[model samples]
Target: MLLFSRNLDKLFFRTLEKQLALTYATSTEPQREEEFRVLNLKHVKGQVAPRRPLKKIVPPPPRTQQMAENQDWGNVWPGPRSFHPATVPLPVRQGYVEKGVSPGKFGNAELMKIPNFLHLTPPVIKRQCEALKKFCTPWPKSLDSEEKCERHFPVEVSSSDYCHSSPTIRDPLARIVSVKVKLEALKLDARARDKFLRLVGDRYDEESDTVTIVADRCPLKKQNYDYAMYLITAVYHESWNVEPWEELKSEADMEYYIWENNASKVNVEKIFGKEAKDIPQIEVYSSAVDKYMNEGESDHTVEQYGQAVRKILNLPSLGA
Candidate 1:
């Protein structure tokens, strides 16, 4: 039994330690107190600050408000450009709407899409005219009448310029050039004038005595103008040009009656011999017959011819 006791004490061995009373431990400690901490915020490092509200911005008043009534428009709008609401002092509006006034200039497409004459005011025009006056020559006092002007400057050129709200500034009709001039201005002889009239066809206005040349074959205005001028020059020179066949044209092929080449002159010569050529009465007879044949028979023509015949043959006038 003593040996079993010795084995039990060896298996359940206890460690030796020094012990002190509770009062002695309380006295040895420097300071002993109870303490508390805030819940769930012990790990936070910095102090929290409140957020301030954002400030609202107010824009400056419209530029037109500061403008004066007598302000120079030329300085306001220096040149051609799209319309601006703030720049223009006027209350102009354009866009259409149901049961509403025209839309204001701000955010308006109608105003921007079209051109404005803001830079071309009356004062501006006067200033431009004054500046240009030095470079211009004064009008000739001698050309007081329209007829006088036409007599001196015979050629009248006409063309058009178009302005519209379109995708492109160019208009097809603007390229066409029209040139007109009086036929008398060409100073052509009888044969040359007849040839010119034939070459120009119906372009000639017999009543106005003017010929109009229209050129639209070219794409540009200047090109069409040049083409029109070339046509006029060509027709003028061509009319004067004489072909070999022209000399072969007989009396029968003549456009008008020729009193000198007719049998009437031959018979008259046979009657009076060479003296008919010197007779003043024979000349009047020739003019009357020429007019009667060329101008178609009329009362005036017949009366004129009868008087000439009476004068040549020394007969009494029927008017008596």
Candidate 2:
């Protein structure tokens, strides 16, 4: 009889569960239905016919090997690289999020690469001490040694003295240092004169027969020609970093030749006419100059260069 009662109870509960599950699956407001079941189902209804409960049916437990073979892990993986955001898994989606790894992020870790030497004038030794205290790490080599490690930074002592001279005024202050007759001056024809003037200039007044030219000089000795050339190369590198030699050299080489001839007088009679000998001379400030001159005939700009180039190209000026 006890066994019979237990079976009957089990069947009743199973039927109730099935009915509840069906109602829940269909009901949009299932929470309300749960409340109703708890509150309004206390009283039994009249004319209670003998209710035959449906037989409880459960499928067989899945085979472990079959499940293992058939299991889908698409959910674990982030969907295709092109997958919609809504379908991607949490871990996979968050993996692409990049948090900044900057200097402040690493607390107490030496984050900055300190310079080996102080660069500013009136060096800050105190700041250096503080930085060393906070970030210095023990390395295999001693600081005094010249040997540098893969990560080794070395400090060197250098001394500099600052000397102030007169405020530079480009009042044409060029002094003649030395004057020598150019050996090649005899070969300076109309073309050579034009080339020389391009480097210097044709600040010559035909009426006055005064001629002027400009040249740059350095105190460097003859032995330092290579070093001086390097300095000139540095100047060229900075000025015409992108310009082609084809555009600049035809003129620059001539100018360089004039510089190589330093302190030499060249005849420009055929180029500047017989009056060229009377043109005012404008010598550029160089260690070779005797004195710096502020006054000359006339300085030429690119626009004024037409007359000068005509002299070189042997072409009649448009003005003429």
Candidate 3:
């Protein structure tokens, strides 16, 4: 019985092994075929990639050759920029070379590095002016002549302008302002004139009778110009003023010698008595003395003074 059981167990185990082997072979055979197909597709794709064609380089045409003679210059150069020989449409050349010639417009480093004003050609300027003419007003009919203009506008303001390729646009000298006006424009009397001269010091020109005021303390040109105008106005108003103490000033404090306040006037008054005003020649004598004292004692002035004194005293002349 044990030998029969052993033989049956062996047969059952052998059948189960055969069944498992067949199942595994059937499942794995399709999986292996799918993986092999996927790998073949990947290999075919790697081998069949389209090749990119190499680009062929082509240079641009020279702008000078393309430019027309009747082309608008304004369009060519609308603003300031580094020089470009090709765009300029001119036979421009730069750089040093041997006896042959300078470098042509093909490659000019010097020309490209420098600034150019090709945009401000005469035609372009004319076109710009024509375009801007509508915004500008015509000159006034009343101020036709320079004299009339000066009469109406006595004060002249002066300033400067500068242009450069700097980091800052401002110029130090541009902030300085000069204001000038004729002394006659103020219509000042002798007292005011004297005061004005004293106040302005060396700024007053005796020959031209012009007052010049310069202002540069302010940072901006407009501020300096306004300050200069303010100074002029202040000087004019201050010069016209009279203080209470001015009336108390004695003859010694006077700017020029006055015949009316001199001791000669008192002596003449004593000699002529209360009728000094009645004497016609007394005025002439006073004028002679004033001229001698104020205008320096010249030979002519001294002779005039002597003649006046002799006439006033009723003395006989040596010539007579």
Candidate 4:
């Protein structure tokens, strides 16, 4: 009985000791006052403070209707109220409309207004005559008529030295053959005159036998040619007193003067008269005259003869 009692006390003590050891091992601090307190004091020594909780940012209460109305901030008026911004108004111009316009037209008669230009001079008449002469093709009759040698009536040039745009006497012989003009002759007979007079304006002076039909302004082809002829005739008759022998500056001007004479054979005669009609001399002058008169040849201007002047003078060519 005593051995059994001793065994029971040993079992009881062992169980209690195991419970104490377990309790000691689990508890971080001493469970009883006499227990050893060996622990990691370094972790306890350094205090890790808890993180501060993030403050929830609650926005101020939405603007109240009464406050909005008072402040004039969020309150919007009704019926197409201009709450949004507007662009600056453009500068307004009222009721300014463009009108239609166009150029004017002139009648045939009105088109012919004479420029009230200058009277004719000798040089002017000569130049005009040269221009006319350039267009003068040989009449078809001249080629066949060997014996007759009938020539084209030269458009004449005569000028008074004293004439300063003053009207001078005209040569009766050089008065352009207005006798056969279609309009004038028509005017002479009452039968055809009125119709033509109506056709062209009343610029014709029937009593004076002086008819002025401006060709540029006139619609008729015959009138144009007649007007041209009349102009040449007027210049020729008006300039009759101009000196013919006055020495011209250039050979071309001299050639023009030579050709202006009524007689066609004068150029040949003039060359022969000066004893300068060598074969080469005749050739050069002939070439110059041909160039001036004939369109079949190359178009020759006055500058071409500038070289010929030195050639004619028997001077060596400067090649300028």
How would the candidate models be sorted by lDDT, starting from the highest?
1, 3, 4, 2
| Per-residue lDDT over 50-84 for candidate 4, one digit per residue giving the tens place of the 0 to 100 score | 99999999966423322432332212221222211
User: How high is the lDDT of residue 8 in model 4?
Assistant: 100
- Candidate 3 Cα RMSD after full superposition onto the native fold (Å): 9.8
> TM-score ranking from best to worst?
3, 1, 4, 2
For residues 202-257, could you state the per-residue lDDT of candidate 3 as single tens digits?
99888977889999999999999899988888988999899999989988889888
Q: Name the weakest run of 10 consecutive residues (lDDT summed) in model 2.
A: 285-294
Clashes of 3: 0
lDDT of 4 at 21: 94
- Residue 104 alpha-carbon offset, candidate 1, angstroms: 3.4
Off by over 4 Å in 1: 1-55, 98-100, 164-171, 255-320
- Output the lDDT of residue 301, model 4: 39
The local lDDT score (0 to 100) that residue 162 gets in candidate 4 is: 25
Off by over 4 Å in 2: 1-97, 105-193, 197-320
User: TM-scores for all candidates?
Assistant: 0.63, 0.13, 0.63, 0.17
Shift of residue 24 alpha carbon in model 1, Å:
47
Model 4's TM-score against the true structure: 0.17
Per-residue CA lDDT of model 1 for 38-141, tens digit only, reads 56675565656777887888988888999888888889898888889889888899978998799988888889898888889999999999999999999999
Candidate 3 regions with alpha-carbon error over 4 angstroms: 1-58, 92-115, 257-320
lDDT of each: 0.90, 0.38, 0.86, 0.44
Better of 2 and 3 by lDDT: 3
